[model samples]
Target chain A: MQHKMLYVLTISFFKSFYRNRVAFFFLLIFPLIFVGVFGIAFQFSDPLNSPIDIGIINNDEGVSNGVVILDPFQGKIVSAIRFSDRFISIIGNATYPNNTTKLFNVQEYNSSNLELAKSDLENRRILALVVIPNDFSIGFLAALRNIFADDPLLQNITKNWEGYPEPTFSTKIFIQGDQTLQQFSIASTALRQITEEFFSLGSSKVKGVTISTESELTTQGLTVFDYIFPGLVIFGILQTLSAITTLAMTDVESGLLRRIKITQASGSTYVASMILSQLILSLLQLPIMFLTGVMFGFPLSSRLWYGFVIAVILMFGITGIGFILAGIAKNSEAAIGLANIISVPMAFLAGSFFIVPNPELKWTAKLLGGNTIRVLDFLPATPAVRLMRTILLGQQSIKNSWFDLTLLSTLSGIYLIAGLMTYSKRHFQSQ
Target chain B: MHKIYSNGIHAVKGLSLEVEQGEVFGLLGPNGAGKTTTMNMMIGLLKPTKGKITIFGKSIMNNGKEIKQKIGVAPQEFSFYSHLTVYENAKLFATLYDVKNCERRIDELFNLFELDEIRHQRSDQLSGGQKRRLNLTLALLHDPDLLILDEPAAGMDPQSRAVLWSSVKSLVRSENKTIVLATHLMEVADKLSDRIVIIDHGKDLVIDAPEELKRKFGHGETIQIHVKGDLASDEFSLIKAKVKEIWPDVKNSNHSLQIHTDDAIDDLSKLLELLKQHDLKQKIADISLRSETLEDVFIKLTGRKLRE
Candidate 1:
């Protein structure tokens, strides 16, 4: 009868909970919306699955040797400069050789209008923009000619020239885009390096040991969506806890708890029913969150089953928190308010919504080990988020996540015990 | 049992009661008169400051679960899951009580409470009378030996109240279940209860069968006469003196007169004769003779109205 009672109440609770429109929105739809918003924002490099778009305003015209030429590409009357077709070829031919996929999806625009490029940048149609000045080719050839010239008079003339220098050209290269966004910064940096290498080709004598770059084939290449997917899952779990807590508080305020107390229903049975119902809810939220993440271009790693287990454990720990809130709050409104007070800030600090950046203070770093621990690490969500992030990103195996698992388990056990103690202490006091 | 708070507030003090099997016992009290406190203690929801409660010869303090299984309590407040339908609420309670036929029990309760038409409606959407019925139905689902209903008919209409009282009476007679009812309505106590306990300030003032109490604390008969005009002091004294001739104690005011005697059958004639001797019959506009009731007994004991 005791166990059957628990099952009966749990089933009833779920039936009642799903009928609630507010619970429906919070537990299911809200996470999907969150996934959609962050998914679109991080579409580029979504695990390096697609080509990135970058804008280049190539205003460069060929440099003239004492002769001026009008170039429509430049849209300005200036020194006729040569175009670096090799540079364009390098960019166009860049590809992920392992996947046989193009690296960049270039969109060309005429120099007659810069607004089109700026609008694309503002609308996020392009990741980064590069603008080359008209005198670029002229300055490059002049510097090369001076470096290899045998005629003393020509060398003297180029050396004495004040308009441009032999070792460096004043053809200004300006790059525009958000430096904070990793995708934009990566493209802009690549463009800058490519431009530097192209100019170095003009001089044969300039030589240095080549430092080749190699991309690491690992889960570290995860996109922002990979990082945020698990956060949303954890946030969804927190919402489940909040919903359960509010319902529990309502039961208390409505005298339902009191009525059940005088009957054959024991406190353990009631608590068991509440926890079981919330656990079931968390399980339901899991696949929905994962499916939404998949639709948002999140990498569906092979270790998703592992993430599912972690999510269920995370739900267990958080539902205990709901019980604590239910015990402390005077009513449902206060329960929700208190839940928000705990979850919102913890979400941000513990990396559910965003990770709190590590402080740069030396003593602070010393106090909290630079990489091992952080101020937010004390929060249970921190380890839970980390565990989920690791499992979802496939960065590490579940076997290696002992610290996170232990911490989350211990926290869950503590909260469940404390919540039961607090709830029973208050629940048994008759009105 | 005694109930003393940490702050030295005594809600119920030295209150003990015994209810016989197959009897409907009414607990009557004014607001804050410790009725709810005593009921809570009896159901093991509260701990008595002193003394203990026993049900079915088992101490509630130690054998709470065993005792609780046999008792069903319908609290004064609306006490059911508002989010669930009436049938769902009944089924939940039935299952918790381990009723063998859960579905049939829910169906029975729904039909008995006249909630069959709206069995699928959420409890919060029900009318006040319907909510009360649902609350009572949930408590009675287990068919426990002892049933404690605290203001069960509260907020109910006349028809619903009548239905609830009749149902309670039939349950006691047919099932031999012991019922402890707490209410403010003296008429309910007068008509429904075999025995009644009137309490005040957490103390039981009196307890006996309803008729026995009426006979012990109540005047056998009361006579009241309404005068047409305000009686002058001399005329009031003359009427009072005439009534005192037969009944030594006469109650007289400026515009009316009252007399409480042991026998209305014998006192009515003497009362009329006294009114004629004073020539107050011409001044008298209305007269009434009434037998004693629960309200009269309550007021006589507490010296205050039941609602006050």
Candidate 2:
């Protein structure tokens, strides 16, 4: 009974799904739009300037030390002032700078306008501000004299001096915020590097501390095209097949189907055939995209086979989800609306475009990372970067592979059950 | 077996009806009179809160698939996929019903309904009459033993209605199909149905053959005839006595007359002659007769006019 029913259901789904042009495009074309757009949007490899309009304010007026005791504000500040050109050129360069650019953006400010500048920084108009104190040179000299007094090598001058780099003259460079942990870490490291380079007594004298990040991404030499090819393919097949709210509503709308229902076709068998038809289309999607990506210079060679399985599962799962949602809605309009609602969120949150452990995590990221580690400790995709790094990079394993599978399966299960229940309930209510 | 159930709806109560093999049974009623609900139950689209239905000697509830194999329905309201061609729509339905030969069946239905010329036209583009023809055609395509139709001709033109009726009649003659037709059109029912069940407010009011029920419960009309000239109450009785010489027990009132009889037409002839013999200037001021028709019988039973 099951076998015969399944056979018929499979054929029915195939015939219905392939026959519709809209369903064809939804399955094969729509998802690639996301892939192409998001891929280009996040590419990060353009040699041209990034389109972010960041402002930098440097309020350091050149300071000269009178006492020369601490020698606090003399060297670095003087050096920066003398060569503001170079600092802006490298430091403020978001991309390959024009040949004429200086390292940083310097906005000279009156003491009165300083508060306004701070407000600007808070408003995100300016990325960072550099403030040089008014008695910078003299205060630094006094502090330096104190430091010399404590210095073992200058032990004889101890009674006459204060601390080194006079407190009032010490310069402060403020990046706008410590809002995100990654940014905060970069800022702190850069600051520490600045302090160290200046104090280093060795021959390898560095000009200033700068934060430069390098990313190493390898799709097993399979290239990004290969990775995307499979994802898009899976999306294609999943969307190709179709089912209404209930196996029975189709019967209700057409008297012929109802008659057939009374004839030999079993409901379960009919429904099963329909789902199987969709699965076939979904399965078709991955390979088509996969081959296209490979042909298009995408390096997707690493664990290439897994893409097929994953895509098929996700496709079937999403289709099931669509059915379930349709089942709950009063009509086709509601079903369409609900499917979009869930699909969009899953795409964004589940790393269909980008991998993120918790995209909502920002300044309090450290806390979330810890919590994420605790709550999502079992699933590899808990921290999205970790999962992508593993899958695309061919990392051996994640925290708990079984846990990842279990969580994903649970999610898929929810969509499936919900779809089935909704379909049944709504199908009956359609009268 | 097909069954529909609704709670808090005293729509159907112990309503046991059957259609023998190759018989046409009509369930007749006014609008909102549980006919649709009853048919829905029979189709298993609705689950009855109480009672049981066995079709072909098998339970319809929980065994709908088995019952569906033998039955077809043409619902009161017709809906189909608007985007599809007639052929496409037919084929899709055939597949949903798991027909073995979808293409062949589509051709068959298209030919049967005389829709072959517009087989490729989108269903939404079809005329109301054409769509209805399609509606009827789909029900017949499956070649089932039992068919159910609910208000099948409510909006159809007479020409289209004739087409539908002819096809239904042919189904009975050719396939020996058992049918349950629910309609309020007494004339249509009287013409096509072998037996009829009348219902109101979810309850069965009466069930019999059209002729039998009319004979059993019909209130034959009472005709009052008023002559132009003045006459006393006793004089009218004398007139009746003379009229009874030809037709007896013809009741009358002063300056008026009353008769309780089924044959209003023939009695009126004899009534006119009596006035002639009395040397009365026989000018019939008013003549009213209560004649029993199906409409009168329905009103008598349901307490509301059939058309209402």
Candidate 3:
């Protein structure tokens, strides 16, 4: 008899949910819309391969104090050389190795247009600005002579070098931009490496050191959208919170709960029916969101079964929150409002769209194992998102995500128990 | 049973009544008169503040789950899923009640309530009369021994109300199911109830069969005489003194005089002779008589109309 009640209630809830147009909109359409918009906006571009925009200001005066280099055909070639100009040329012509894509889209600037360049940097048109000092040539020559004086082979070349009287000319190359932006950090690092390369041209002892990267998985050509696809799928699953909350509240306000209370069916039977129905609906959301994501350049993986498991666990937690909301809210309108207030922020805090940095104000606990759990780990979405990204994008096996899976299951159990207790106390017990 | 709300309003105070097996018992009261509250307690939806309630010879407070299975309630509000069809709503309740052969039971209820024609339509799309019928149909789907209907014929036209009343009567006559009918409509109570308890301010004023209540508290009949013109102050006093001799209760208003007596037919000739002797026959325009009703009994007991 209990099983029969559960079956009928589950079917009835499922039918009522889908037949209501507003519930249908929230359950599937709203999250699908989010996927479509974010997919189109990202355009499947790789962030690492994108070029950085930078502005260069050359303010160096040419120095020609009898500096000469021996050419093979022309003997003792001597002329005024502007090292700042040469540095700017090297920056403008720099490109990735074996690729035609330029490293930086360099914008030239003069002393008068320096403010304009600064304004561009402020507006994010250019990620960084390079300001060459006026004594760049003198500083370069002096530094070269000093390096020659230390090496025996290059001491003869700089013994008769007559250029600057000072042993060192104080020169500063300023890289300016907003430090908070990621693009600014990349641009500054590249600029510093280029400066070191230019100074090492005259030294024979300096050796170029390059770091080569290799991927453990076959994720060589992945785009930004690939990393964001799993988050979007989890986002769709979270909307079930609002749908279930409003559905339960509708039952309470319509007095359907009271009607069912008079039946032989137990309170657990009704709650189980609700959870089972929403779990089925939440499972359907995973495939639909995955198919939509695949159409938008998201890479398909063979480990979709892992995602299914995570979706079920996450839904248990979400439905638990829905139960609590329905119990506390006075009516369906307030339930909807409270649902949005909880689910939207939870989605963001769980890093559904982008990665959230660790906050300073967090709590940590030590598990039975040697593992430590952070406050964010208590939220089921956190582990669900992590497991999805690892399994789907990283192409890792289920064994690699055991910790997250366990954490998610534990939190889901806690939420479900809490939800059942609150709902039963509020709606099932005698007033 | 006694019920005092958390806000200190005594919704039901020392209210006690008994319902026999296989009888239509009416609970009559005005608005805010604790009818729903009493029914709620009977079904274990509420716990009495200071009294005990037993259903099927078991304490409702301790054995609520066991007792509720034998009972059914049709609440004042429409309490089924509006998005589902009439048949689906019936099937859902039938399943919850664990009715044997669910499909056949639903079919029988549909036929009984005349809901077969609109069984496939969503409940929200049905008319007010159709919705009320569906509400009662779902409650009766389980074939409960004790069925509680709260204002079953409310918000219906005369034809629809008659159909619902006929269906309820059939349920009692054919199935012998005990019913606790709570309503403010005096006509419904008078026609359907085998016995009724009239309550006001959460206390019972009277409880008896309809005929017994009328014979005990009701004035037998009222005789109204409409006159052509208003009587002079002296003339009105003289007529009042003359009518008071026959029947002690005499009322005058709006160029009309009303006299309450044990029999209007027997008193009609005597009243006319008195008016004729007073030389007031020329002023008499019309005369009519009305028998006593349940509403008259309610007014006599509560000093207010049932709807007030």
Candidate 4:
């Protein structure tokens, strides 16, 4: 009988809300506008396609000795410039690249003029400038002596230079541009990787310590859209809780809440119907955002159901928050004011707008054995956003998200119980 | 029950009364006389600071659900959802009451209250009198054993007021339903209530039948004469001396003279004859004689009119 009453009330509230055009604007039109503005701004722009311009000042002076060189098979008079400017040897595509394509737009500066190169870098002509010292080739050959120690044929060529003082080679790489932190980080990292690869190749056959680099096929590169959409979806779900709070406060000010209390309807039934109605509205809200996101080319590596499951769990937590707001507020205006206070800061700090780097507050948040505090991990929206990112980006499966799901579920349960208790006491006992 | 509000203002103080079954008990007071506070306490909308209330042999605090099922309250304010149609509001209440045969019951109420034509209209769009009737109908939807109507005929036209009075009269006569009513309309209380309680400043001043109260505090007969011109003290004393010779009960204020008599039908002609002998009949603009009423009793007890 109680279930039947709750079901009836839920249906009635849905009908009432359906006819409320003002509610329609808040519940549906408002979020759609948010999605539209973001979609148009980000649809064609992928953050991974950041432009990187690097200048290489290759000043390596090579040796020209009249020594007979041996080809592998015919032993012909094939001469090779043994140690050349290897920094200039690296190549890159002029445009954005796929996995097999070069990673940068590399430019070679012939003159070692520091002032001219600095001017080009300052004028944004290059993201970074790399300078190879003049003794680069001599140092490169000396490092290879250990690798070729067993070969006598190679020993005679380098016998004249046996005690040659080893030159300390300095490869000064300057990162200069009006670039953001993320842009500067990406450019500097790429330049170091390319320079190290060439330096490693100079001592190719060294058997003692082998250094090899591999890029995994399973880890997909994330675009800015990939990083932000999960947070936006979670944000959209949590925002509906404020709308529900406003509706509940409206009921209170209208005296509908008191009138219903005077009836045979129990407080639990009223709260249950309200929560169920909000859940239904949230279910309606998620799809519009998901569809808009997909239209704007938000990548969907995992199936759609994974995002939906996370959304439902997040709705429970958000609805609990709505109940707490409803309990504390006296009217619709108060409810709206209180809801903004709770939601606005959480949205920003919990990574709804932009990622709050874990390192920024690492000492504070990571007080537990180099791990983020458990309470911070379950701060309503943080875990949901992270879990959605991992699942939708195909970085982690559902089985690996047990901790995140448990935290969200526990928060949902605790908040729901606390909200119900507080609301019941405030409304029933006070009245 | 007693009610001292959260602000420490004593709204109702140790006020207690028992309403008999099948009786239309009237609660009367001037504005701010704690009538609303008392009614809210009776219906469990407010918590009293002292004392307790028991309805149907069950405590209201612990047995609210059981008591609420037996009682239906129509608060003085407009409490129905204004966005819904009259029919929708009635249907909602019927559903809340869990009444069987809801549609037929609603149809019956619609016809009985003359609301059949406007049943589909939104409640806010209705005339004030129609809204009042609809409010009363909603309170009666569940056929509660105890119904509380607070100023039910307020903002109503005389015709609508009469219609509601007749319906309430029939409900008590036919169904023997107990009702607790609070109103400032003396005529309403005087005509409908089997017993009336007048409260002032959070205290009950008197509780008895309307006629009994009138007989106790009311002068027998009141004759008011509106004079055209003000009389001097000597002239007023001369008229008072002559009228007091027979009736002996008279007061003069402004240009009006009020005379209390045992029998207006017998003494009215003699009083007018004395004025004519003095050639004062030409100065009398109007003369009216009426039996003492509850309004007079209210003013006699509170030293002010009911609306004051």
The CA lDDT of each predicted structure is 0.74, 0.56, 0.79, 0.72
| Leading candidate by DockQ | 3
Candidate 1 local lDDT, residue B85? 91
Best by TM-score: 3
Encode model 2's per-residue lDDT on A332-401: one tens digit a residue: 5556666555544544444444433442223444754433233332222222323333443343243334
Flag regions of model 2 displaced more than 4 Å: A1-216, A219-263, A280-309, A351-410, A421-431, B1-7, B62-65, B77-112, B115-125, B215-293
Model 4: per-residue Cα lDDT over A29-117, one tens digit each: 77777876787776665555646666767676644454333322233433444343434555354334454444567777776477777
TM-score of chain B of each: 0.87, 0.78, 0.89, 0.92
The candidate, 2 or 4, that scores higher on DockQ is 4
Off by over 4 Å in 3: A44-220, A360-372, A395-398, B224-259, B266-288
The CAPRI-style docking tier of model 4 reads acceptable
- Report the lDDT tens digits of candidate 1 across residue range A16-52: 7887888889888887787778878885544443666
Clashing pairs in 4: none
Q: What global local distance difference test value does model 1 have?
A: 0.74
For candidate 2 chain A, which ten residues in a row score worst on lDDT? A212-221
lDDT of 2 at B250: 61
Ten contiguous residues with the weakest lDDT in model 1 chain B = B230-239
| TM-score, prediction 2 | 0.59
Candidate 2, residues B239-297, lDDT tens digits: the string is 65666676565656567666766777777776666567676534556777755566767
How many clashing residue pairs, candidate 2? 54
